[model samples]
Target: MAPPVSESPPVETLDLWLLEAAMELPTPLHMLVEPNPHIALNMADDPRLSREELCERLSLLAERGLIRVHALPDGLQELFSPEEISSAIDARQSRTPFGYSLTDAGGAIWEHHARPDWSRFVNAGQEPSADEAQDAWVIEAASLEAADAEFHFHESLGDVHQPVGESKHGEVLTPWQVTYWKTLPHGYRLRYVTVPRPADPARSRSVPSRPPWYTRVWL
Candidate 1:
């Protein structure tokens, strides 16, 4: 008979897991309070944490200096004290949701505890390959369009004789051809075709011809 597979160990409590999620960026209170399918799949039990409980947890986290609460969406620059934040939540005065972000201490704890492994967690409901997870470069940008435009402007350049956006391997791509992308802690991990050199070797007569085959770069 085949040996039974052992179950994986739990990483941390649901509250701490939420802390790690906030470490990525400032998240709205509604997103945290809502039922996350990803978190539910990993945990043994999925409890619909009440607003009171959620606020209490946030207050506790804030008191410990692990997180900061803001009024949102304009109050990101202004942080609220634990007592004040809790009161605001309890009062339900604001029409907009509150935002939560990790403090320096919280970031430190996340770095110490979280692994850089992508296979362990799902990104956009799909697991990335080990190579992609390890080799991908993190890009910080306000939006995907901005990041894509910047990448093309910096990486794609050549003389009139040679076409732009053509990889060394002769694979031609447009400026906005971002094949794959995933969210990261600070920004995004994007995979796209890269042209290391001019597509036409003859344009640069002195340089030797490289091998023909396009390779994807994880940015």
Candidate 2:
């Protein structure tokens, strides 16, 4: 007989964009006090995600208290913007009426965490501003060389094994350094440029075409 199925491990990461929307409510605070559809419409902009996926995220956000939800009531459409009210009206037709609004804790989290981290994930391939450059730390290249001693590359996987966004060469940053990097302003993505090999390839520290040690980070 086949072995019984093991339970899945607990999820450690939430959807980053979903979390961002929950924390940043574009509309007025008063409208939020009473649940309305305005916030979800504003927050969920990813065309790739279907409305069902967006609803699932909304439910998750509600459970976390980043947003509050309420059952739809008659004539409550007055509270929402034209777009929100229209969506709510359509939802009513399907008997799946619900609304959500950001909570105080959500706003606090936006101010402290999400807003600061927003720049890191969004803007790639641009140079960092002067203020952002100050936040970077220059780590010795030797440490990364040691880390890359066990490096293996699988060309077939393409970007699957690669970092989600731009990365600082073969060496990964320490967790605190990563957090600091996230707090930097937008347009600054960390990546390593390939340094040309010297006349004596044997003396070069960088690996052939795939250098594990990054000499510098282009902010």
Candidate 3:
């Protein structure tokens, strides 16, 4: 018997392009928000980056399913919100918040992308301009090496720990971080990476955002 024709649609060309864009920005914001968005995205120090630079990186994040451009307030009802998308501004005036970060879907992406070290940050500033969320990813990746030693000392560790997006509802798989954690008790870890293949295309980590720990090749 022959293999059945797969119904899965071909990967959206635009999505692939966007993923590439996300990789390019690799701004490094995840470190701030991962454990808690309000505390990180809102409270951290501050820095600056240009719109052109941000737009390019954000484009990739959008493609990676990390973030979306649809305009709507946050809430379950908003998921289905409807609006007219004009080519002129892409509805900029109405956009809920025109910026960058992992979309609600990013929860799952973090699930997959995160390792025990996903929570750390490097020399990143507390605050960043334009794509604040995008920049977090980089800080989050770099801090891994540094935080591993001092994190346990923090008060936050004493409480029942859980990832920012996770809830009592249990493990959730979201589009933002397409990857899920492999180990539960051991802290965030990668669930899978395009499974190993002989000379398969390497795993693509957003540049600068991924950091040095992800040294393995072939995604």
**Every candidate's lDDT:** 0.45, 0.34, 0.29
lDDT of 2 by residue, 90-113 (tens): 454455465544555444433443
Task: Write down the RMSD of all candidates, one decimal each.
Answer: 16.7, 16.6, 16.5
lDDT of 2 at 206: 46
What are the models' TM-scores? Answer: 0.41, 0.27, 0.27
lDDT of 3 by residue, 132-156 (tens): 3322111112223443333322212
Error of 1 at 205 (Å): 44
Off by over 4 Å in 1: 1-12, 35-47, 73-96, 117-219
Better of 2 and 3 by lDDT: 2
Q: After superposition, how far is residue 65 of candidate 2 from its true place, in Å?
A: 1.1
- What's the residue-level lDDT of 167 in candidate 3? 13
> What is candidate 2's local distance difference test score?
0.34
